[model samples]
Target: MSQDLLFQLNGVSKSFVKGKEEISIFSDLNLTIERGDFVAIMGPSGSGKTTLLNMLGGVDQPSGGEVSFDGARVDNLSESALTRWRAHNIGFIFQFYNLMPMLNAARNVELPLLLTKLSKAQRRKNVETALALVGLSDRAKHMPSEMSGGQQQRVAIARAIVSDPKLLLCDEPTGDLDRTTADEILEMLQLLNRDHGKTIVMVTHDPAAAKYANRTLHLDKGKFVQRELVA
Candidate 1:
């Protein structure tokens, strides 16, 4: 927890009780993510990529070790405090575009603001700007069913970024798209990383997707096995 580090995980470990057995996901895992770094986590199925992402985002707690963000221990925060902290600090993008079917694109993107104290006009302005950033200005009024898979995902990205969060966590962001659409999404993510200086930690199985990241951390059997820097 310093100005240079956005996240610091020291000897983090998580375990779950599966019936009568204990399943350990991570043990003594240490990691540090600097501000504005675009990192990709790659691992085989069940290697705990998602588990680590969840831990970083404050959705899950480590059974041991420490997780600190911006000099504060996140793992020790209360559930209510973590919820509030996540609203102001963290954004999440999932494999499926989790948009409300009843709301239009702009409204869906604005949903996060409801938790804030911003005025209606301010919320609308932020939503418009975020949609424009993702090149979806014209599609703001479209429903989820009215758009293509890629467009829906773009709306999801807009929603994630609308809060202007310092950190973005993505889990298989392009998992449900075609090759061309997935490439377009990856390019947009790269722009966010390079141009906007957003700290991104993404989990992906595709090597092509990993190429866009500044660094790739590979996990094996719940441990860091390899680290590669592209470019």
Candidate 2:
């Protein structure tokens, strides 16, 4: 294994039993992700892009193969161990800004830190830094309901990075915004990758959105059909 490799999925398969039929999401898939690479997974609905993201994030385990991260077998971990591992090594961003309506921006960004042993002062500083990174430092005290959709997503991004996780997994991070706002968010993601050296894997349906990534993998019926490098 090269030192730059961050994830290795060998012969990974995922299946679900729905009623009397068994549905295979991905069969015998092999993938490798390098550190500091921003990758986008693009496919139509039901192509299992999000499922693959869940696998990478350790939220879902493969049924038949191996998933390794930083030389550890992540797919073999117990549920509790996986949870702890995810908390420290993975950051997740969803289509919807998953912020609490009542909690202000700083508090929402502090939620993940509550799982760790950081002091209140440390958590506050982290929150401030994260919010600043996302260009929301002045809005740290505003409630989610008071912010626009784009601002809310920025807050969510702040929350995701507050812990400085190894990988940032985003499922449609700009799905709910206008084109201009979406472009801004994508630019921030680019800055995160280029300047901060954060590794990000995002799932997006829009071809324009996929262009922001270093490479895009196209999936069809649970299989990767193409790998395109961004020029």
Error of 1 at 136 (Å): 0.5
lDDT, candidate 2, 1-231, per-residue tens? 899999999999999999999999999999999999999999999999999999999888899999999988999899999999999999988899889999999999999999999999999999999999999999988999899999999999998899999999999999999999999999998999999999999999989999999999998899999998994
What does the lDDT come to for candidate 2? 0.94
Per-residue lDDT over 18-130 for candidate 1, one digit per residue giving the tens place of the 0 to 100 score: 99999999999999999999999999999999999999999999999999998888999999999999999999998998899999999999999998999999999999999
Report every candidate's CA lDDT: 0.94, 0.94
Residue pairs in clash, model 2? none
Alpha carbon RMSD to native, model 1: 0.9
Candidate 1 lDDT score at position 154: 93
- Per-model TM-score, in order, reads 0.98, 0.98
- Window of ten residues with lowest summed lDDT in model 2: 222-231
Residue 156, candidate 1: Cα error in Å is 0.7
RMSD of each: 0.9, 0.8
Stretches > 4 Å off in candidate 1: none
